[model samples]
Target: MLTKELIANIYKKVPKQNVLSKIEERYVYAFDASDLHEKVQIPDAVVFVESVEQVQEIVKLANKFKTPIICRGAGTNTVGACVSVHGGIVLNFSKMNKILEINPVNMTARVQPGVVVGDLQKQVEKIGLYYPPDPSNLKVSTIGGSVAQNSAGARGFKYGTTRDYVIDMLVVMADGSVIRTGANTIKNAAGYNLGSLFIGSEGTLGIVVEVTVKLITKPEASEVLLAYFDSVEEAVNSVNQIIKHQICPTTIDLMDNNAIKTIEEYKNCGLLCDKQAALIIEVDGFKTVIEAQMKLICDILNKNNAQNIKYAKQKEEADEIWDARHSSMAACAQLRPNVTTDDVIVPRENLSILIKGIQKICSKYDLIMCMVGHVGDGSVHPQIPIDMNDKDEYTRYKLAKSEIYDLTARLGGIISGEHGIGLVKKPFLPKVIDNGAIDYMRQIKKIFDPNNILNPYKIF
Candidate 1:
């Protein structure tokens, strides 16, 4: 419970006009992107902090009062990471969004955590530098949330995830102390490597105030290859074959037939829906290199029984191809009253097996499961359109999800691929993670936050 003095201290420390206690206002901050959880409640007041110093002051008061502090960005998280489970204080950082510095010489950009991903992407692209982590929600998702969740994208196959480019960060530690975690240099062997830790900590350890990420020069050209398969297994086979050929595309994403149908239905685009599965492969580099990669990709795809292949040559076609890919969540979400998206990473060799297993699980649950994901990385998503009003539907969904996770574990896979193990996936974590690893994380949590005041009821 928040005492009157504690709230007063918070009001003094934060922007007085920005603090909100109205029920309707509180309702807006209640839940995040997850639909599995009940309606979120418990934040005593939502305080919008404008600067790093404001974050520090808010953290200090929250620590002193033993109140929960949830660092909220754009609130686009799929897991309950942004949910205030305990009625403490919601540290709203949406006002702190500022692209602080763009160093063209170093090819790095320093940004406040609250900067929206797309806004930064546009800003960086104007200067010929590229920030490639393009989560579907990039238009609205904050970079802080992306870093907190270790967000990935179709480009991850070539460039790797967000952490790979994050060279430095400034974090507000548990005790309200601001510490620079990393250096702008390429290599550093400093103690503990807290920079990497803070990347996917999910707001459990510290609040990220500033982020410095490496940027690469924009590719000279990009090509999108759309290949259709007679069977989903054939599609998976094509992915494995593509990787085996050592021809790494910038992105090789797989979309199931059902998912394609949803996208086509929603967008009214003339997308190929006459296949069991499809591989949307994108390659980028110099014109000659892109053309060569395209030839090799098409040859390998055809060798793997690709029924139909269409290559996009113009900017409109490129955008059309990506538009179908990015609109997946909204298309899938409209299938039912709710949708539970889980990321399960498996060995590339077992991608076909996992797809088959997912089919079985979906059939068993009498649910429609369209499996799609970053096939190049073996990180797939099996989205279940859940009906919130029906308890029995979820009961079966729980079993279906459990079986899928178990199968993934058996195949040397993790419970989460790109998405973090936030509130929704915590229950199934033990199915994939070793007991010792979880124990170690719990111990680390204890050491960093003995009071458990930082984003409680989350990844633990």
Candidate 2:
């Protein structure tokens, strides 16, 4: 039970309307985007914070009461990163969304934690600037959540992930004290790269209040092409061949036969469902070089046994191709009652084996899976649609999940590529990370959050 004094103290720190203490209001904050069916503990209170001072005040109150302070954005993370497992105070950043500054000369943007990723992209693109960490759900995902999970998408093959752009951050430490992670300027040769520690920390060490991200000039021209292959090997080999020819496309995303058919059925996007796999390749650069890049990429695709290659002739067609690729999860969800997605990455050489292994495992377990990935970077996202209410199916899904991680380990790859190790992946962290490294991580966690009040029992 929440004490009257604690409740009163919270109300004093924030506006009365911002404090949510009713059971109905608190219940909604218990779950995130993770598809886990396990019962979750509802938070005792949910507060919509508007300023850094309000966040610090809440952190101080959390320290006094020793309650877990879970920082939340849109709660779109698929790994249960923002779920209130311990039922403490959930600090919602929705009201704090703001883009404070956009410096064209410095090529940087300072933003509040609640700023939506796609919204920022549009605002920056109004100028000639580009912020390139494009998560699949960028339309709804928040920058703070992307920072916590180090989220990446198809563009990651060329632009890198969220960590590459974040230059500085204003973090409220566990003790309600605020600290700047890096300098405002781009180059910071300061003591330690403290920002790196918190970039993928999943809000365990501190609460990110403000962020400064570096930006690059927008590409002058871009084009998208869909290439179908007779077999998975042909698709994988085509990716390698493209790289061997010294051609670097912005994204080389792969979608298996299941994904192609599923998305076609889900949206009738004109995808070739008869092929075993498809590669969605995009190239961007100076307008003068686009035709040359497309010609080279097309020649390589035809040489590698690409059955049918289709290049988007217009911007509408390009958007349709990308929309189909990005809708893999949504398409898969239509096949079953629940859908779960996993991120596993291996070396480019082992890409074919990883894809085949996952397909075989899913087939053996009689589970329906739609596989899509950023093959340019050797990261695959296997989205499985299942009926979670079926006990036998859930059991089989668990077994297949463990075996998939084992296969990933044998292939010399970690379990996660961009998604952080939240509650769903915590049990399997040992499969990829060494004990010594995890021990050090725990020690560091203790040093920063001594009370264990910041997103406790996560990412271990």
Candidate 3:
């Protein structure tokens, strides 16, 4: 409980209007996109700051009170990154949303922590620049959250994830001191690349108040195609052939029959649900080379016995195909009251085995799973829809989840690719990461946050 004097002190640091201390107000920040059934702690207070100085002031206050300070953006992460587990002060960055600067010559965009990813992309693309790190829910996910999780989407196969784009960040350290991780220039041979350490730290290290990300020129042209296969092996063979021919498509996304049927049932998109698997490939480059890329990709797919091929001839058609692919999660969510998605990645050669293994595990558990992934990068997202209220079913779901991670380890893969090891995956981190690495991580955490007040009890 916060004392009256402590509350008054906090009000002195932040405007009275921005401090949320009521039970109802605190309830709003209790959880994020994580499962509602998980144990959640309602924060003592929620504060919104509009400037870096205000953030520092709040951090100082938290230090004095010895309370945890969890930074929040849009709170859309699937791993409970923004959840206030120990419940102290939830620092809301929504009021700090702003694009500080955009430099065309340097191809860099400086932005606040709360800026939406899609909005920044649109702003940059308006000037013929592109920011490629899209974490599926770009419409609502914040740049700060993306950087914290190193988020990436289907485009990650060609352009890397958020970690590759972030050149610098103005981070508020645990002691309320501010530090810039890197410089504005793209190439920094300077001291240690500290920015890499905090990108996926999940707020355990420091709070990112502002970010400067690198951008590239927008592609001149792009096309999308949906290739259907009679079997998963055939789809994997087609992907291998495309890569063998030296065709570097932006994304080679895979959707199993479950995902296709779910999306078709929900959106009525013209998808071949009868097929065992479908590959959504997008090639983008110069205006003149699109046709050749399409032809080469089609040839590869046909050679692998693709049952049917549908290539988009117009921007509208491309959007329709992508919209259907993006709608897979929402469509699966309609199948049950609660849905959980896992990010597991294996080598491209083991992609077929991982997919088949996950499907079999889900079937053994009697759970409904829809599989979709950026197959080109060897990452897969197995989205399972289930009712958490059913005790027996939930028990089986947990077992299936563990087995899937075990299979990923056996296939020489980690439990997470872009998604972070938040509270949900903390138990299985040791299965993928080495013990010495984890020991060093804990030591580093103590060095950065001795009091363990900044998003404590996470990642480790």
Candidate 4:
């Protein structure tokens, strides 16, 4: 769909070293965090865009040539959002990485797209402020990718997801016009909350160039607890019981025995954990406040007949305790070279049932499936490990995926949480979204980018 002459022409309109060809340079743009997508083919060209104006020129030229254009950040999306399926131009935003401004007094920071989430956290904490959205891939994921997908994290159980922290953003539209969606102020009765709307649009609406996010005062004290259970039901119910007690922990995460065994086998880290289910819980506040909550947590776990409840006192101990939970993606990756991870959000009370349903499906398929979740908010990722070389593997994989989504919807759950409806979930979207809403969303996409040039074939 593209040729060297057309790419050369586009590069001629920008700075030197901005354009790439199909042979070797274009190979990097072929894939993303998604381990199983149909396939990835190298794009005809790749462009390293550094500025909003440059993006504008590239988009205009892409529009002129009627070629597909993909906007990519750290390429961390668990879907094919950045894949150049039609072989057009791939635009990488790494060069535009810049921390523009930080306002500690107001607890807000303005940053360009390519800032790493962990780097942003480090920068804010140094100034006595905190950016609390810490995704599992924070060290490698970029803010642009996080905001684009409305990324959530372990902190989401307390601080809420990235959407809650984002105040405003600078987005570049299809025709290269730059528009600001939100304000830095605390509250506004503005026109539709466009900023919130675009937060999880998954690059289908526009490309986020700059972001303004709110920060919070870091908690002075924290406590980590690990509660083990012989049954998933008990472990999941414990989370609800803890919530009913009105003790909101900063994070309450779950790891089934399969997940633990997989991680322990992969790292030989001596988890010393063999229970059927475990909850790695964290509560943060002032020293006295968190201490009281910690006691209440212990009581609840004991009441649930938890097999074991372990506590970590020091900061280092807490870090070590949570390391296994944090390395879930890596642990699962070691299980198979290819993995298809799905996110489903159910009511907090139904977490156990949802997990049970997933286990049933995994067993029925005779698959070696592992599970882990953000138990606080009821977001679980059941990774479907695959050997992509085998064609029949995906056929069963698709069936399992179909049953999972349908079952999640039947249980009053959502198809996706934290992750957006990128290409991977496009087909299932119709199953979850109301027809009226889907039609309106399609209309909105048409209104914004009539030519479907912003990011074609993403959410839809």
Candidate 5:
């Protein structure tokens, strides 16, 4: 819907180097990390926004033309949150990446939406602070994408997700008006908490231009423990036992046999491919108490018939252990031409049943699924590798995906935990959410963007 006149208007709002309208350049913004071939669409124009004013101008222009304005950050989100499914305008935030303020005294950092998550962590950690919302690929993922998806990583069990850290945000509504969701301070007992409405809205509600994130003091000591189990039940039982002991580790992540094998073959991280499941547990606290915690955790694992357990002795060793888990998606990509990852979560008590159900469903469809998850929070990500070029395989993959969501709903779990319901999961969202709730969501979208110009048709 972006006409030549409207494209010229957008170029007038930014520098000459900021706007991209060439066919080749627009093609690059068509897709994201999501492998859903059916949902991909190239935008008519890709505009690189350098400031809040430019974003507002673009939004106003979009509203005027009734064109969709899809905001894009690093575009690393696995749920196609940044894809332009409709022919409109794509707002690239790469030029707006800047850490505006780091208030050490207040323990909050005000940053542009385009700032890299890992880079922000490094900068904050330099001042003896921590921002714990990690989305696996934080090295390249941007703060805007994480905020939009409400992303959490392995550490989510202890530290919570991006929604917990984001105290305030500068959002641009569809009408080109600006609004601050909350104040810069941490504990706001203020009215409504309007920020929550847009945090995980997946760019469907408004465009996030700036965010103020709360930070915590860095822990004195932390270590990762890799434990192997002969059966998935054993690994799950170990998790329950550890929780029963009242020990709160930073993470309780699990990987199934297929995930282990893929990582071993791709990265050769010395992972035991023969193990049915593996748990990566991390404990952090005072240096003196870490040893006691590790000792107790070891006892629990051993009691639950853990085949073998290894703790990282050095920082490099800890990185090596985490590398295996972080490399899961990349490793699965090596199995076939295209790989799709899903997020499903249930209550902790049903974690084992969920895993087994997913395995059975994938096997029934003859799909290769590498499963990994943050078991502490009962979330699972099953990465399935398939050749999209093969029509038969693609059909089977679609069927398997639907069945997996059905199993998740049966186990009292939603289709997504960390990954928001972008285009990939929109079709199945109604299965979990009630019709009344969906109606309210639709009403909210109408109230926010009456013209349906801001990332239109997402999350429904």
Candidate 6:
């Protein structure tokens, strides 16, 4: 419980207007994007800090009161990472949003935690540079949330995730002391790479206030292609054949028949509903090589028995295809009152098996599943739409989830590839990771946050 004195101290540390103590205002911070069936615990207070000094003062108050400090950025994470499970102080980073610096010379950018991922991408692209970590909701997802979850989108097949770009961060520890995780330079070899520890730590160890990320030159040309397959096997084989031919496309995304139908119904993007599966392939390179790359990928698709193919001829067309793909979750939600999405990855070779198994599991539970994935990286997202208020349906969903995780572990994959192990996946962490590794993680958490006040009871 937050005592009156502690609440008064929080109001003193920041502008009174920045602090929210009323139930109605604090209620909004209680949950994140995760569709939790359980009753959520609301935060006692929500505070917005605009500067590092203000964050330090809030941390000090948290330490003094032994309260949990949950860091929230857009609250777009699919997992329950930002949920105020302990009903403590929620740190809202919206006011801290800013792009601090863009160094074209150094190929890096310094940004506040609340900087939206897509906004930064646009700012850098204006100067012929690129930031590759493109989460699906980049337009609204903050850099801090991406760092916390190491978010990666379709481009992850060629570029990489947030973990690859994040080089340094200014983090406030549990005791209110500020520490720079790493030097601002691209490469650091002097000491431990503490920045990495916090990349996917999910706010359990420290609060990240600022981040410096490396950037790369933007591709001169790119095109999107949609290939329809009569069977899932054909689509998966086409992905393997593309790799066998030594062709590196920017993205190789898959949408099963269910995803195709749902997205078409929701957006009317002209997706073929009869196709059993479709591959959304994008190739990026110098203007001279774009045509050659597309031709090679198309040849492989034909050889793998692709039924039909469509290519995006211009930027507008490309955006239309991508917009349809990104709206998949919203489309699925139209089927039921509540929708839940899961991230599970396996070796590329076993990608087909994992997808098939998930389909079977959901079928056994009589659940509606719209599946999509980055086949190049073997990451699959099974989005299931269901009525969470239905007790019987929710029970079956829980069982199906457990079995899906079991199948993933057996196929040599962890439960999550981009999403972090927030509260929703915390119980199954042991199914994929050994107990010894989890113990070490806990020990490390204790070292940084002995009070367990930093997003307490998370990731273990």
**RMSD to the native, candidate 5?**
1.0
The candidate with the higher lDDT, 2 or 3, is 2
lDDT of 5 at 134: 83
Give the Cα lDDT of each candidate.
0.85, 0.93, 0.91, 0.84, 0.91, 0.93
Error of 4 at 95 (Å): 0.8
lDDT for 72 in candidate 6 is 96
Task: Summarize candidate 3's per-residue lDDT along 1-460 as a digit string, tens digits.
Answer: 6667767888998889999999988897877877647778999888999999999988888888889999888988888788877778889999999999999999999999999999999999999999999889999999989999999999988899999999999999988999999999989999999999999999999999999999999999999999999899999989988988998899999999999999999999889889999999999999779789889889889989997799888899999999999998889889998888889999899999999999999999999999999999999999988889988888999999999999999999988899888888888999888999999999999999898999988888
* TM-scores of all predicted structures: 0.97, 0.99, 0.98, 0.96, 0.98, 0.99
- For model 2, the run of ten residues with the poorest summed lDDT: 1-10
lDDT of 6: 0.93
TM-score of candidate 6 versus the correct structure, residues matched by position: 0.99
Model 1 Cα shift for residue 85 (angstroms): 1.8
Looking at candidate 3, the ten consecutive residues that score lowest on lDDT are 30-39
> Which whole-number lDDT from 0 to 100 does residue 320 have in model 1?
87
Residue 149 lDDT (model 4)? 89
lDDT of 5 by residue, 359-405 (tens): 99899999999999999999999999999999999999999999989
Tens digits of per-residue lDDT for model 1, 415-452: 87778877888888888878999899899888888889
User: Model 6: how far is 239 from its true place, Å?
Assistant: 0.8
Alpha-carbon shift of residue 143 in model 3 (angstroms):
0.6
Once model 1 is optimally superposed onto the true structure by TM-score, how far is the C-alpha of residue 346 displaced, in angstroms? 0.7
lDDT of 2 by residue, 1-460 (tens): 4567888999999999998999988887888878768988898889999999999999999998898989999988888889977788999999989999999999999999999999999999999999999998999889999999999999998899999999999999999999999977889887989999999999999999999999999999899999998899999999999988888889999999999999999999788899999999999999779899889888888889887788898999999899899888889889998889899999999999999999999999999989999999999999999998999999999999999999999999989999888899999999999999999999999999999999998999
